[model samples]
Target: MKRSKPRLAVFKFASCDGCQLTLLDCEDELLAVAGQVDIAYFPEASRAMAPGPYDLALVEGSITTPHDAERILQVRRRARVLVTIGACATAGGIQALRNFADVAEYARAVYPRPEYLETLAWSTPVSSHVPVDLELRGCPIDKGQLLEVISAYLAGRRPNLRRTSVCTECKARGTTCLLVAGGVPCLGPVTQAGCGALCPSYDRGCYGCFGPAESPNPPALAGRLAELGRGPDEVERLFRTFNAWAEAFRGGGRPA
Candidate 1:
């Protein structure tokens, strides 16, 4: 007897949906992915709302409300394997910047009826609500890495992803060191290797869209940035951009 195709579901919470678009932007590769698994519940792709017990679930976005927190529990129960995609799902994205300030005050100032509003104080990652089997980091995750993860899942193996810093990618692409040569405040030394050192190639400093790499020395990098005439506040602002809520980057963003 042949095994049935595994059902795959993509869930969203509070996000800009850029990561979801990356999957759709796969274009030709998406056709191959379609043949491998049954896209059961991807609202971004199709309107088909297939029922639960999905083999794999790709979750995008952060938990920003009580409803989203509860929904993730249900998603966890139904999905055999849950992989969080993008910064929102893994590190709460830019929305998690609210975790630093007063959310209630912001709401009151923005909305006329703050009393009617119902939202969580903090925008938290999915892992904070449930166990995440794997996490893909980025503002909008790299498509190649996303495909590798799916292929690995189908083959019943671990994804072969590099945990090295973006500096490694820069070296591979023969891109000049923006920080050392130009004295630009770059996050290449600390950011994860996935974006292929895109910013550096354009003579711009890395913004750490892929979050922190393995054993990243962000404090050391912060010191270097300080030496480059970047004040503590400026360095903090840089670190607190896309992956602000990420654990390793969080401490790095703080004033020493």
Candidate 2:
């Protein structure tokens, strides 16, 4: 008898859909992945939907509405392993800036009739709504690392996701430190390793798209920024970018 292929499902909530696109962007490896697993559901890739008690579910996006709150519970029930992909699902993404501001005012600014829109006051990460098996952090996750995660799940092994800072990648590539050499404000000291230091290689500081590194010393980094003549507000603004809702980036006080 032949063994059944593992069923895979991909889900989305409130997001830009960039992370889901990363899987599709994996043009070379996607066909190979399809052969290894049953692509039972992936709305971004196909309209053909499959009901699930899925072996794995890759969720991309944050929860930003009452309907999504209820819907995610159902997803959790149907999925054996729920892995949140991208900053939106893992750290609440840029939309989470609403959490610090007045949602009512925001709605009025964006829409002519705010009453017609149904939304929560704040955007929150997937873990806030359901128990997550894993979280893959990034603005748009690295395709190579994403493939490794899928491969690891299929083999029943832990995905070797790095918890280091982007500074490590910068050093490995022999890229000059933007902060030290060019006097650019960089989150590379605290941002997670991914993107292969793309911004720094192009002579720009890292923008913390991968979220905070493990136990990042953001305060020390803030002090360094001050030495570089960045004001307190500028330092706060830097931390409040892609992963503003992440605990490490948010710090002890309220998010800026």
Candidate 3:
């Protein structure tokens, strides 16, 4: 008897749809990927749809509404293996900054009838509501990493994801330490490695796009940034970017 192809579904919530685009961006390898799995339901790419329960589900974005909060539970039940992709799905994305302030007030300023909007008090990741099999971090996840994750799950093995800080990637790429040499306030010391130290190579600081690295020392990094002339508020803002709501960054990146 031949083994059947695994059914894969992609879901979205409150996001810019950039993570989904990363899947489409895997143009060259996509056909081969499709050959391995049944692309069951991906509204971003195909008009066709399939009813779950799916073997694998890739969720993108955060829960920012009552509907989304409820929908994620449904998604969880249907997926045998659920992987959250991008900062929005893993750490609530940049929109999570609203968690600090009044979302209703911001909604009122932006929308004509804020009362018409059925939104939650804060944006939250999928893991906040349901159990996730894995999480892929990044503002928009790296395509290579994404492929690796899928392949690993299908092979019943752990995804080979790095847990090291961005500083390690900089060193490997032969990129100079921006903070040490240029007195630049960088989050690389605490930020996860991905994007292959892209910003640091261009003489820019890591903006913490991939969220917190393993056991990150955000406070120590903040202290160093302060020594480099960055004010406490500036240091706080750096930690409150794409992965602001991540536990490692949630305390405002300051010394506790």
For all predicted structures, in order, the TM-scores are: 0.97, 0.96, 0.97
lDDT of 3: 0.91
Writing each residue's lDDT as its tens digit, candidate 2 over 76-149 gives 99999999999999999999998879999999999999999999998999999999999998989999989999
Q: Per-residue lDDT tens digits of candidate 1, residues 1-256? A: 9799999999999999999888899999999999989999999889899999999999999999999989999999999999999999999999999988999999999999998989999999999999999999888999999999999999999998899999999999999899999999999998999988989999999999898899788888888888778999889888888889888788655432
Model 2, stretches more than 4 Å misplaced?
Answer: 252-256
Judged by whole-model lDDT over C-alpha atoms, candidate 1 comes out at 0.92
Give the Cα lDDT of each candidate. Answer: 0.92, 0.92, 0.91
- Look at candidate 3 and give me any clashing residue pairs: none
Worst 10-residue lDDT window for candidate 2 reads: 247-256
Superpose all Cα atoms of candidate 2 onto the true structure and report the RMSD in Å to 1 decimal: 1.6
- In model 2, pairs of residues that clash are none
